[model samples]
Target: MGRNVKSRIESESQKNNLSLIIIILLALQVILSGVVLLRIVNLEKLIGGTEASEPVPVYVEGVSEGDNPALGPEEAPITIIAFSDFQCPYCASANQLIKEIMQEYPNQIRYVHRDFPLKEIHPDAFNAALAARCAGEQGQYWEMHDALFSNQEDLSIEKLNKQAEILNLEMDQFNNCLTTRKYENKILIDLQAGKEYGVNGTPTIFVNGYHVNGADREAIINIIKDVL
Candidate 1:
């Protein structure tokens, strides 16, 4: 009888142990599944499956269209004033888009590029802006502007000089203008104007006085469509 009782107790204990092991395994599976699910959601957010959220367009008053590098007719129906940094990748992308838009609209839009180099982050940006302006003195502002954006990864003084040569600009004059920092005050004014217009980032564009922040392609197009 004692043997029988011992056997029964051993069986019950074994069963209990098995049940606990099973519960632990289930709990582990649940935790792992939750972690995987969380990772998937985070990945989705990072990859950006949807279109970027657009900011509400506000008519920013006193936004200056100062004597900046511009394209298209001065009296076009839509004037796009862009505050940009030459070293900013987003600005480069936006520059291409703006160029395309210019081609698309042809005579309907005036596109102006204003300097807003983020000096702290992009050490070479201020100088790059100077280089473009120097090239402008030789009647190749847009050419140098395109070159700078194309070679944003390398905007050293040496590279700027090389680009000037490529554009056949008078090297002495271009270098002198850059060395003198001829457009320093003008760039500073643009930076100040950008700050006043609430431009805390690169490629901040104002279309006919409407503020469209960031390199938002759709927002830019939609705004232009509305204006036209």
Candidate 2:
């Protein structure tokens, strides 16, 4: 009888130990679930914060058209000014969009192109701006402008010269104009004006003095449509 009682006691002890182990496992699972849920919540909050912090569009006062390359009638009802970098891909895209916009709107929109060369990042950009202006002296500004953007991967001095030749510009005059940097002051003025107007990146556009901060196709179209 005593042996049977001892055996029963051992069995009861084993069952108790098994129950404790199961409880511990359940507690660990609960902790892991809580940690995962907390992480998910925090991740959601971070994404929400980021979306909430998107910059609001700026309305700049006195945004100038500048003495720069232009398309469409001078006295067109709408003036669209762009501060662009020739070496910037976004600027190139914006340039194409502007072309389409001009074609669509015809003579109603006056589109002006101003230099805002990001010389630090795009070492060739300042020179490219000069090349365009040099070609402008020969009444082929838009032609050179198109050429530079079309061959954006290569805006080296040699390439600029080749482009001038392709356009049949008097090479001596174009070379002198580019080498002397005749439009340096004008380009600097444009850069300074862009800073004042809160332009921190390339292809910052102004539609009737209202700032559209990027190559935002939809925003640009909407603004122009609304204005018209």
Candidate 3:
């Protein structure tokens, strides 16, 4: 009878042990599943950030008529949209390259300039952009555009006034436009438009809607050729 009772107790102990093991396994599985789910969520966030940073091709839209400073034929097969800051040295470097490209493919390429001044790093760039827009009002946008890039070191209001004089713009009208922030809303629109197109840095060039982040002359020529 004692042996029988001992066997029954042992059997119950084994059952209890089995139940504990099963519980442990289930708990472990739940923990592992939670970990995997967390990893997947984190990975998704990482992918989202990468995609946001990548440049995507976009059609020209939202820009008003005569709002953008442009060169080349209106019906050119290729269009280059440039997001640039006046005070950025890289943008200054790219200016001559862009001009050369336009000269090379004068009829085939239409280049548009959009303001994307990084005011955090370049405090004078925003004012320079404003000055350029004010000059645009006088039908001398391209001339002021040239002067701004040529004398990038002197981007002060005084220098911009002098540039307006050189471009033969009426000082009374230009100064009033500048002082009164006549095109402040327009410039802000340009800056926001550039940001939406993933223009994180200066001189972000797009040829026929294709993103060109670097100043690779050969690559730019090839893109232009492909569109042509």
Per-residue lDDT over 60-105 for candidate 1, one digit per residue giving the tens place of the 0 to 100 score: 9988799798989988999889999999999999999888988988
**Model 3 TM-score, 2 decimals:** 0.70
Model 3 segments more than 4 A misplaced: 1-66
Candidate 2 lDDT over 8-71, as tens digits, reads: 9999999999999999999999999999999999999999999876454567898988788899
Q: Give per-candidate clash totals.
A: 0, 0, 0
Write candidate 3's Cα lDDT for 1-228 as tens digits: 999999999999999999999999999999999999999999999999898773434444443223688888899888777788899888877877888998987688787888888989999998999899899898988788878888988899999999999888899999999999888887788888877777789888777767775666776887778777
Off by over 4 Å in 2: 1-56
- Ranking 2 against 3 by lDDT, winner: 2
lDDT of 1: 0.91
Q: Name the top lDDT candidate.
A: 1
How do all models score by TM-score? 0.76, 0.76, 0.70
For TM-score, candidate 2 versus 3, the one ahead is 2
Model 2 RMSD in Å is 6.2
